[model samples]
Target: MAKASRRKSQSFLHGALILTASVLIVKLIGALFKVPLTWVITEDGLGYFNTAYNFYGPIYSLATAGFPIAISRLVSESCTRGAYRDIRRIHRASAPIFIGTGTVGFALMVFGAAAYARIIGNESALPALYTLAPAILFSCLTAIYRGYYEGLRNMYPTAISEIIEALSKLTVGLSAACLILHRGMKEYEALGTVFGVAAASRDYARSAVLPYAAAGAILGVTVGSALSFLFLFCRHRLLGDGITEENLKNSPPPRSMRKTVSRLVRTAVPIGVGAMAVNVAAMVDTTFLQTRIHNVMEQNPQVLLSMYQGMIPQINIEAHTVPNFLFGCFSMALTLFMLVPAVTQAFGISALPNVTAAYTRGEKTHLKKSMEAVLRVTALFSIPAGMGLAVMAGPVARLVFGARPSLPITSHVLVIMGVGAIFASFSTPVNSMLQAVGRVDLPVKLLAVGLTIKVALNYFLVGIPQINVLGAGAGTLACYFFLTVAALTCLCRETGILPDFLSIFGKPLIASILCCAAAWSARGLLSHVLTENLSTLGGVGAAVLVYSLSLLCLRAICRDDILMLPNGQKIAKILEKHGWIR
Candidate 1:
């Protein structure tokens, strides 16, 4: 029993580590896709791509987000009670819901594409929206299995599917974008037109080709989602979730399908609403940021232009595409800012089942320990990463994206967004824990207030000539800061368990400060002797070394945290011999 308990506990961190490792690979592949695609289609084209995605976000959340989490939590609770038969029933009951919602989401994206594009004031985004619509259905299908396996504390299927999707995007999406651009340019050169549209000049022809190129790139995402769903479907059939006939015979009778579906809806609605609030905030950002920036451009073009002075492209200004162009630059910064949260999101997903199991069993001590470990791990990662990005925003941007003309704007936005990433990253795991402990509606309320704050701030700030695009970053920082603090407070109150705040947050804060200082000092020193990219790399290396050492010296991580890893017991013994951990 003790050995079985240990194995169960290990599954949480082991699963988190699996998903985290996969996230790193997927993000690396994403960089390969987005960075080169940015060059192929330019920042303006990326704006169209992201605009379509922004619209997709809320609808996708509405369709698929809550149910998987609902399923995961329900499955975890059922597993804790040894209801293997009910687990099978839960999977069976989820099918119709997923199929129904996915179909509706796909239809909405397709039929609403033109209207959404016009509302966002960028008609060029329509084709990308249409191409990306099918992903909604496929992603919903994929989510069903991901949530089910995650509830069982299995991360392999989700991780594998994500990698398959990312690889598809990198290979198929990038190739398609490049092919479209090349063919369009070649046609312009040969026949003085691009795709049957006569152009006044080569540049004009390229401009005309961008919307189609962005759509072609998005087509890869649609294809990848479909392929990922197929893989999940195949895997489920072959492996069969490890439930045995004996287990099923011993388990209690399964709930009625109607009862199970009702329970699922009761659990999913609040969670889905919270998820939708977050995505709607993204949609708000998309709508308000562009509209406000367009307002600034129309009312005070010279003031906004003068702020960036020679950085804003003449072609963009002349075509009145400065809004989309600036949005594209902001998106570039967002691409990097999101990586921190993406990594921590794995922690949230993995934590749900473990925390759920402990809480359901009324293991108060175990629950507290699990909560602290999740928080501590989240802090140890998010704090330093956010700080490092803030400290090295410029060099990192220049390194990843090359010295594009937009670096000035992109780097500036990244500085603010890097700070925001810390709060955003921490919020995910905190909310998951809250849901696990049965306060599922708190996240929705908190997110609603936070989204209001964000929208109001962006509406006012982005319209300011000087703050135009930077305002979006500022709004994000403000929104997440409030959400993180409030969510953590609510978690404590609901769980009636105040975790070791100092150990969870304080030590990591000190370590992260040192890490950022080391990065900054190292970068400043190395810049005098080395090239910019090399110096940035050196600074990052220094930060990692310092952060690792600081964690050991401060003992920010505990033995249980270490024990969560593969070979963790042996590693803990080594650290204990050296008195590096307690």
Candidate 2:
């Protein structure tokens, strides 16, 4: 019985890990496209984009009511009740409802574009405003479909479809952004006057040029949306076909659509609200960061328009979002969205009953052993990984973002975010543990408190003279670090084991110090050996190798620790069918 349970647990963990990896790949690819697309559109537009999206996002999230998760919960319930066909039926019914809601959301974005632009005090924003409208609707459809698929007794198709959608969206968005930028000054001026530029453009002694300029912006919008929809809809068709072909034909029908949706909506309301609340906390940062900046610069458009502006777009408002959105969002949020939380929750859910059963039978030792294993493993991964990110901060940014004209601000912001990145990674598993044990409110409350601190800090820090966003970055680090400590404290209190914090700190601290020194020293020699920025890959390569060797030499983590490391010996052993040790 114990062996069977252990196998089941391992299977769940393995599956979750695979799904997480796929999601991360998809997210990273999407980001690869989206970031450049954004950069192209916004020399100064990132701040503008941030203003609109910050307010628009909460509404967008609310419109979906987090339907995907709702669907998952419903599907799980229906499956247990032997109502598979009913699950499909519910989604079929809900599809149009989601679309209709999305239409309203789309309309709100489109019609409200001018108002939003005016609200942000930039007439130039009108074009981008209308352009993003289609995304809202497409995203809405994606959410509903994801929810339905997750609830349908499998998640691989959903995961694959997301990858498809992300790849397609990124390709389309980036191509359009690049084309618009490459066309040069004419397009740049045209973008500036997208909505109302015609009036200002009329002063252009050549009034005939107005029409062509206007057309470019309009064409950019139409094509981008058309491509996104094309990709998403195609993915949907392929997924639907795959489902029917794989096992649905042989499977029984799901249960009543109404009942399934109702139950789902009930659970999803809180979950959706939880998700929205978390986003709103971010919105608070977004709303305040720029305001603080504007207060200091006195809204100097010239200063705001500097080439360095790209370094601190509204996208970089929190000091953390840019770094996270660029890369870490996937590894931490997208991948762990399924892996750490889902797997941990599965473990907790499965174990809770076992613990209860064991305790009833007076098996204290079994309970202690079980609880200790969970805490220890969670600490082992979460602690070291967070430290690794914090340590590798500057070098990773250098390697990933490169030394652009804007590298100074971008790199600095990224390093500052490094601490928060670690906290985010560590806290995820802790929150998952909370969720695993059915303590949903705990995480919501935690996020709420963290957000409060974030807001207060961003408000105070974003305007600290030239410190500007650097202080905001500090605020971000503080929020997550505080949250991690709180979560760790709570975990210890709940489980009765104080993690060896001193030892946990030892590995990451040493590893990061070594990495920083290696990167710094490497920098001195690197400039002499190679042309500036030409040696990006080489510099980063040497630095990473040194960091790894230092860690091993210091015995920070055993050879057994690496499962996903490149050229991992243990992985080779398993793949080659050698007797393996974990």
Candidate 3:
């Protein structure tokens, strides 16, 4: 029994690390894809792209968010009880739910693309919206397999499939966008028209081509989802989940499909609602940022324009595309902000099954240990990363985006968002733990209040000429901060387990502050001798070094945490030999 328990714990940690590594690779590929795509489509074009993307988020969440989690939790619980047949049943029951939801989501995005575009006041985003719609169906299709594998404590399939998706996006999406842009430019230069439409000016010609270019880029995302689904489908058929014939024979009879579906739906709805709330917040940001900025332009144009003097282009103003242009700049900062959460989100996904298994077995000690480890690891990564971004926002922004006119705004927004990213990153794992422990409804309730607060703050602040889009960042910070604290409190209350707050949050906080100070000083000192990009790299390197050392000195990571890694026993011996860890 002890050996089996030890193996399960190791599997959990290995699964998390596998997903984390994949996230890093995916984010790197994403940076390569998005940074250059930004240059190709420009910020104005990106606005159209992002506008469509924001609209897609909630629908995607609605279609697929809760079911995978539901499937995972059910499979984990059944696996814990040694009911292997139920695992297979859970997977079977999930298929129709995903297919139905995906179909509905795809149809909605296709038919309702125009209305969403009109409501957001960016009619140019329609093509991007339409092109991106097919992804919803495919992604929903892919989610079932991801959830099933994750539930079985296998991370490789999920990791490999994600890499396949990212690579496809990078190769297919970027190429298509560039091809469209190059062809459009060639046509304009030779014929004074873009794609047979008369262009009064070069600027107008480029503007006319941007929507299609954004759509072309979106085409890659759709293609990637389809390909990812194909990979998961083929892999599942070729390599059946490692359930043995003996295990299935020993298992108790599986529940009827009707009961299984009912149970899955009951588990899924609250979790789905919680997940949808997060995406709906993004949708809210998209709708309000554009409309409020548009209102500001209508009612107090000079006040807002004066705040961003020379940054808002004349062409954008003439085309009434100022909202999207500004949103695009915000989105640029958002690209970096999302990377931290994306990594932690993997932690959340990896935690759900392990935590569910522990809780299902009524293993109180193991549950608390799992909870603390998840929180500690999340803080250890998120705090330093978020603070580093805040401290080095300008250098990092300039490094990735070059000298675009929007850099100043993007940098400023990133500074605020960097701090917000910490709380945002924390919320994912916390919510996952909550769901794991059976208080799945708490996250939805907490998110509802938090998002209400965020929306109200955004509406009030974004309208202020001086605050403008920075208001959105402030709202994100407020929303996630509240969600993190409240959810943590709720998790403790529900579980009757008081996690060591200092170990989980304090030591990391101290280390992160020192890390940020090191980064700031390093960047300042290196600027004299190094190029901006190189200096930024130096600062980042210094920050990482300082943060790692600080954790060791403070013993922020416990021995058990170390032992969860591959060959952790040998690594722990080395650390203990040096008295670096207890």
Candidate 4:
């Protein structure tokens, strides 16, 4: 039994590691892809691009975000009982529901694109919204297969599909945006629409190109989702055959379709509502920020136009600039979104099997230990990752977005958002654990409370002339901080599974602080000898090395902690051979 338990634990860790690595790779590619994209589309175009996404965010969440976890949870529980037939029933019932939601979402976006743009105070974003509408449908369908695979503890399909999605988005999105920028610009110039014209006409042409670029970039989202859906569908077909064959041979009775659908919905809706709260917050940011800006400008075209006057021609500020600029400023917060999948994916994927299994067996002690291990792993990576991002925000932003005049502001935003990212990382797992234990509604309630705080803060802060975009970042930080605290508190009270603060967070905190100091010092020293970017690169490289070494030397990373990684055994062997560990 002990050996079996050890193997099960290792299997869980292995799955977490695979998903974590895959998510990290996907985020890196997505970030890199955004670099040339920002250059090609410029910040103004990015603003519109973000505006479209802001509108799409809630609808997409409504369509697909909650079902995966719910499906995974239900499927994991069924698998734990070895009720294989229920897995087939779950999928059969889930398909129509997911398909219906996706269809409704797609139709709503297509039909309401103009109104959404108007509501967001960015009429120019209409085309981009239209371009992104199809992605909702594709992504929803993809989530079904992903959820199924995850339930089966198979993460490779999701990983491969994600890579394929990212690559496709990068390739198609960049190519399309570049094509519009170069070729499309020449056409406008040829028609004397924007080029070699008076300032007014030139301004008109500049504004005209932004929507096209935004739409082109958004097209990648649609294409990428479709490709991902295709890949997942094929993989699921090939890999799911064994399970299907077994179900056929066993000929186990299936549940009623109505009951299956009802159960899945009952489980999924709360998760969906909670997940949608994040999207709702994002939508609120977009709408409130733009409308408030428009109101502040008093809806006067000239006043709006003058805001962009005296802009550095090389830096590309425009009349309709603030909304896009504000969007671009806050868009850097997406980097925080990237760091989340590392902690969240690991915990979220494993939560179903580990947390659910323990809960089902009424093994509170096992559950406590499991929760502690997961929390330790979460802090092991998330704290350092968040702190590292904050410490190196400038170089990271410049390296990713290029050294533009706005890099400083964007980097500053990243720092603030990086802190929020840590909170979000914690919040995700807590919420997942909550759902895993069948308390799905609590997250939705907590998220609602957080959203209220976020919206209030954003309204008050974002409207300030001086605070503007930076205020949005502050509000976001506060929002997730609230949710994280609330969820962590709730998780402990409900499950009595309090993790060791010292081991889980204290050591990581100390080590990360040391790592940050080392990295900061290295950056300062290298700045004198190298260019800013190169110095930053060197500093960050130093930080990673320093953090790893410090963790080992401080004994913050124990043998068990090392062993939980996918390559933990090999890593432990090497460490022992070098006298790094005994």
> Which portions of model 2 show Cα errors greater than 4 Å?
1-13, 27-42, 74-97, 111-116, 150-155, 181-259, 299-405, 427-433, 487-517, 534-536, 546-582
Per-residue lDDT tens digits for candidate 3, residues 377-426, read 89999999998888888889999988877789999999999999999998
- Score residue 200 of candidate 4 by CA lDDT: 42
Residue 450 of candidate 3: its Cα lDDT? 96
Candidate lDDT values, in order: 0.90, 0.51, 0.90, 0.76
Model 4 lowest lDDT segment of ten: 1-10
- Runs of candidate 4 exceeding 4 Å displacement: 1-10, 194-204, 241-252, 299-318, 340-343, 573-582
TM-score (all chains, Cα) for each model: 0.98, 0.67, 0.98, 0.91
lDDT of 4 by residue, 373-397 (tens): 6777788778877888877887777
Better of 2 and 3 by TM-score: 3
List model 1 lDDT by residue over 388-429, tens digit each.
888889999999989888899999999999999999998889
Model 3, stretches more than 4 Å misplaced? 1-10
Model 1: CA > 4 A from native:
1-10
